[model samples]
Each structure stands twice: as structure tokens, then as C-alpha cells.
Target: MPLGSVRYERVIAASADDVWALIGRPERLHDWFPGITACSVEGNRREITLQSGLSLPEEITVLDDRLRRFQYRIDSPFFPYHRGTIDVIALSDTSCAVMYATDCDPRTMALVIGAAAAAGLDRLTEIFPTPIFPTPE
Candidate 1:
């Protein structure tokens, strides 16, 4: 079967620079990616621990500051063909849009990953709420 994919995006109230600083760094993935409890990276290799205490190995394919894009591939034997990409696009000085995309074989993996990616985007938005100011009456 061919690989399937999905992309999920969310607007975060924090600046793109702030969002990129954390998301672009593979070591801090658990901070906003739900179900991920911890992450460790060395060179281009990464290992992430899930809520179930299961660990998955991964490879960092690209980390471009100019494009604010982060791409990686899951190396688990169960998931032989999987790629994940995240892009932080600036909407304004104080806000940005986070685009999370995933492609995986077995077709069904796309649905599973899409849900996780959407939840992760939601988590990112929740962490950076916009401030509201009162107007003079």
C-alpha cells in the first residue's frame, strides 16, 4: 500500500521565534507534543519516550532556520516508512501558525498520526494564549 499523510495547523499567540526555539529543537518535543514524555537527541539520531514508557528511535532529516522547518523520520521497525515535518510561520510579531504534517505507510497510520499531530498543535496553542486588554469606557 502507498503512504498516506495529513497536515494539521494551529495559531499560537507567541512569536514565531519563540515557537521555533522550542519546536525546532528535537530535545524539547515532549514540551508540546502530547503523549511524548521525554526526548533525547544526539547528532542526527533521536529517541522519544511515550506516556506508556515505550521508546521510539528517529532520525532528524532537516532543521532549517531560514524556512523555520523541522523534519524527521521515525525508524521503528513497525513504522518503516514515516516522515514528520513541522513548520512555524509567522503571522505577526506576537503570533504564528504551526503546521504539523506526517506521512506514513500502512495507510491507517495516517489517521493515528493525524490525531496525535492535531493534539500536539492544540497543546502548542494552549501554552501561548493571547493577552486581552480592556478598552476605556
Candidate 2:
């Protein structure tokens, strides 16, 4: 079956290292990711509880510090295949771009996960507020 994919990017006024420090950790999803109420990670596996009380299992695929990329695959029985990737790209010393991408077999799952990903990016922006520049005299 062909997979459906979606990608969302947000430019945050924060260093890439700082951005990665928050979202890069698999065990910290509940702290920032919208809709996630709680998260428990053990070894390479993770279980997340949603605001709706639904729980889902996931597998941590990649956590590359140097590249600032975090990838995971949803291991829920309902979906045949689902993969999510979060990448932080450095735009400058004090700015970076966050990309959230999702791939799913059912196609519609992509839309669902994509929306949540969008909100998660928004939360990241809120957590790392844009820096204000001082006006020249």
C-alpha cells in the first residue's frame, strides 16, 4: 500500500541546540507535544496517553544529536504503518527551523497526525518565545 505523508515547519527564534534539547528527547513528549497527557519510555519503546485518554505505543527510531533529528514509528494495532520525524535546522546563531513530518499507510492517519504535529510545533514556539531586539538609539 502506498503511504501518505505530511510535513509542517515552523521557524522558532531559538538556537537549534536549545530547540533540540526539548523535542529531541523521546521521554519528554508529554511536556510539549499537544494532546499528549503523559509519556513513558522504556528502552526503545514508548507509550503515550492522549488528552482523550487513548493510549498509543510507539518505537523510537532515531535520535541524532549532531543532526538534530528525532524519528519514531507508531506501533498501534489500528494503523498498519505510521512514522513521524522531527528535525531542527539551524537558520542562524539564534534561530532555527523545526520540521515535523508524518507518513502513514491509511492516508487519513497522516492528516490526523499532521494536525497534532502542527499544534506541537506551535507549543514549541510558545515554549521558546521569539527574542526581541533592542531599538537603536
Candidate 3:
């Protein structure tokens, strides 16, 4: 099956380190993601429960602290796409760009995955604290 990809980017008023810190902590996902009610990580795998009482399982595929990038694969029966990546890049002292990308078989559930990503990003922006850093002179 051919893979289809979807991507979303947003500029957040937060440092890369700070954003990474927030993203890296699995247990804190609900704080930034609206639909997610809880998250738990066991070893390299994570389980996320949605507000709708649905639960999804994912495995950490890539975790590069130096580069501030992380990737995971969704193993839930609810999602067609089996994998996705979340990346955070420092744009400035007080700004960072977050990008989420997912590749899945278009024939299966591309639309669902895309819509969920968009909603998740929106919720993340709304719930997370604004980035803080020293003023650039």
C-alpha cells in the first residue's frame, strides 16, 4: 500500500528546550492535548486515553534529545496510519516551531489521522504556556 503523509506546523512562544521538556514527559500530555485525558509510558511504549474513553497504544520509535525530535508509531486499531512523528525546532530565544507529520495508507484512514492531528495541535497551543526567554537585543 502506498503511504500518504500529512503535516502541520505552528509557531509557539516557547523555547525548544521547554517545549521538548513538555513533550518528552508522557504523563503530561493531557495538559497540552485537549482530547487526551491521560497518558502512561511503560518502557518504550505509551498508552493514551482520550476524552471519549478511547485508548490508543504507541511505541517510541525515535527520541533524539540533542535534536529535539521524537517519533512514535500508533498501534491502535482505531487509527489506520501506523506511525507519526512530532518535531520541535527552536526558531528564536522565545519562539519554537512544532511540526507533526504522519504517514499512512490513504486507503485506510488518512482523513481521520489528518483531522486528529490538526485538532491536537490546536489544543496544544491553547493549553500550553507561552514560551518565555530573554529579550533579544
Tens digit of lDDT per residue, candidate 2, span 1-137?
A: 78889999888889999999988888899887888899999988999999999999999999899999999998977889889999999989898888999999788889888989888887887899764332121
Q: Which candidate ranks first by lDDT, i.e. highest? A: 2
Q: Positional deviation of 100 in candidate 2, in angstroms?
A: 0.3
Instruction: Indicate the TM-score of model 3.
Output: 0.79
Whole-structure CA lDDT of model 1: 0.85
| Regions of model 1 farther than 4 Å from truth | 131-137
What is the TM-score of each predicted model, taking all chains together?
Answer: 0.89, 0.91, 0.79
* Location of the lowest summed lDDT over 10 successive residues in candidate 1: 128-137
Tens digits of per-residue lDDT for model 3, 1-137: 67777787777786778788987676677777666788998888989998889888888888889888888888866556567778899998877888878887653455566567767666656655553433221
Please, what's the RMSD in Å of model 1? 4.9
Looking at model 3, the pairs that clash are 13-131, 14-131
Candidate 2 structure lDDT: 0.87
| Candidate 3 Cα misplacement greater than 4 A, ranges | 77-81, 106-108, 128-137
- Ranked by TM-score from best down, the candidates are 2, 1, 3
Better of 1 and 2 by lDDT: 2
Residue-level lDDT for 104 in candidate 1: 93
Count of backbone collisions in candidate 1: 0
Each model's lDDT: 0.85, 0.87, 0.74
Clashing pairs in 2: none
